[model samples]
Every structure is written in structure tokens, then in C-alpha cells.
Target: MKLKTYDISLVGMFAALMAIGANITSVAPFLQVAGVPLSMQPFFCILAGLLIGSRLGALSMIVYALIGIAGAPVFAGFSGGPGVIIGSTGGFILSYIVAAYVAGRIVERSQNPGLPSFYTASFAGIVLIYVIGTTYMYAALNFWMEVEMTYLGAWGIMSWFIVKDAAFTVLGAVIAPRIYKSVHRGARLGRRSAA
Candidate 1:
């Protein structure tokens, strides 16, 4: 399907939002759990899918990842590059695409998505984010990093992340319908103005 300019712009906007979410911890170092800074990525990822649908949301995530891999300071702690992708948090970075797609796909199944749909889709996306991210972190720490954390231990480590993301997921769902309406209406107005 051909994407209108509005769609393309939303994709770029979400990509920029992802960057901002990743580094939000930099200015607030006290917002850490178990020595790991809390990241707002899951929130933005869900918003991207809920507001823009699957394809554009995933595209935005991909663009964000590429920018980081290309040495942009868009990742957590203002860090970036290929090394970040191979790091313990890399799985979480990669999981954003799938999470957004899954959330969007589920919500898109309904003709007119509502609060219930948003709740379901947001929760589903958070599950994928934690599963993929925790598993990869476990593998990276045990194998290359030589930290030797058991699978269960990895889950335990992610417990804090889970709590934080769960809250964010609910917030996203609650606010999404309003944002979706505003954004789509604005796009229509923009088109009419252009015409």
C-alpha cells in the first residue's frame, strides 16, 4: 500500500520519540532498578503501534535501531553503535519492532478499537518485550559477558522492569484513544488545507 506523506512523517516522529525515550534515564540517574536504568522505550513502542498501526510503527523502530547502530547517541545513557546491539540490552532494542507490530496487529483486528482492545494489545506487547529482552540478556551475560546468571535469575532481574513497564503499558492504553483521534483528525485537516 502506498503511504501518504502524513504516514511517513508519523514514522519519523515515532523514531524520534524512541530516541527520547531511550535516553530519558540519563538526566535522572536515580530512576534505576538493580543498577539498570529504567527505560521508557516500551511506552513509546506501544504508542507507536497504537497510533500509527503495525507497518509504520515497526519501520520507525527499525529506523531508530539503525540510527543507533550508525553511532548516534540514541540508546540508553546516551550510548550507541553496533556494540550496543551486541550488548546485553540489545535484545530489548530488537524486541521493540516485534512488540509494536504485535500490538498494532492485535488492535487492528478490530474495526473500532476501544479501551479493552488497547489494554489487551498493550499487555501483549509488553510480554514480548520482556520475554525477548530477558532471554537475550541472560544469554549475553552467561555466554559472552561471563556473568553466569541462570534463566530464572534472569527473570528475577527483569522483575523490576516488568513492574515499570506494566504501569507504562496501562498509561499508554488509557491515553492512546485520545491521541489517535487527535492525530488522525489533524492529518485530515492537514490534507484539506493542502488541497
Candidate 2:
């Protein structure tokens, strides 16, 4: 029997959705400081981008957000509906699209010279996600809630979110390359057997 090769786009989409779901499940309690409560959930977004590449990563995030908005309980804490998107966390949610796109593109472009290159690319993607996600959160809270936040306060919030994401990114960076190599090897083996 001839083995079928999966479409790259489909693989990307499935991976993206799975990453998003992983992110939704990984959320913990919100970090509150000076009455500004922020959920730490950007790691999943970064992971999606790093694994899936820019376009599919962004598309996956958008799809997940849209699904939540359409009343699916696919978001953190099983929360769903349009209210979540329009809440204080909305900007962060929206930022995932930007973060994922930027990260994914960086990862895709850095896919050479083996595992070190992949890890470097993943790190770049992580940085991109944090920058975009934190900036969006700061702006959203400042504008919508009229919070008087100092630079330190903003940094504090950024730090809170960034640490978690960075940890996850590091973990992904370590494991993903091995998984990719294994899959490629398996595919090649299957093809040889078929021949």
C-alpha cells in the first residue's frame, strides 16, 4: 500500500489548534497588582507560532478566539462567548494573533543548521510574542480601565506574563526538534518500505 503524505497546511492547522488548546488548558489564576488583574497565558500563543510557523500560527489563534467568541468554551477556565473577548483580557487575546504570526515567521525562516538554529528561532519567536502581548495588555488596560500605571507597574505586569511564556518556550524548544526529526525519519522509513 502507498503511504499518503499529509498536507503541510493541514498539519500546521492541526498543530496550531492543538497548541491553542494546550494554552487554554494551561492557564492559572490571574496575577493582580494594584488592582490590575492579568491572566498569564501567552506561552501557548508563542508555542503555536514556534511550532506551526507564522501564517498558520496566527490563523490558529484567530480561529480559537473566534470560536470562543461564538460561544464555544475553548478559552481558559472553560470560558466562552463574546464577553471574554471584550473583557480586560481581550487585548491580550487579540495580541496572540500578532505574536503568533511574528513568532511563526521567525521560526520558519530559521529552520536551518539543525537544533541550535531551531531553538534560536523559537527564542526569537518567544521574544516577539512577549513584546506584542505585553504592549497590547498595557494599552488595553490603560485606555479601557483608565488605570494610572507607572513604567514599573507595566514592567511588573510584563514580567509576570513573560516568565511563564519563556519557560514554556524553552521546554518546547528542547522537545520539538527531536519530535520533528523523529517524524521525518519515520516518514522516510515508510516510503522506503513502500518502494
Can you write out model 2's per-residue Cα lDDT over 18-50, one digit (the tens) per residue? 434534424533444444333334555665666
- Winner by TM-score: 1
- Clash count, candidate 1: 0
TM-score of each: 0.91, 0.67
Per-candidate local distance difference test: 0.90, 0.62
Task: Output the lDDT of residue 30, model 2.
Answer: 40
lDDT (tens digit, per residue) of candidate 1 on 1-195: 566788789999999999988877777778787777778899999899988888888889999999999999999878999999899999999999999999988888978999999999999999999999999999999999899889999999788879989989999999998888888797787677767
Q: Give candidate 1 regions above 4 Å deviation.
A: 29-36, 188-195
Clashing pairs in 1: none
Model 2 TM: 0.67
Question: Candidate 2 at 159: error in angstroms?
Answer: 2.1
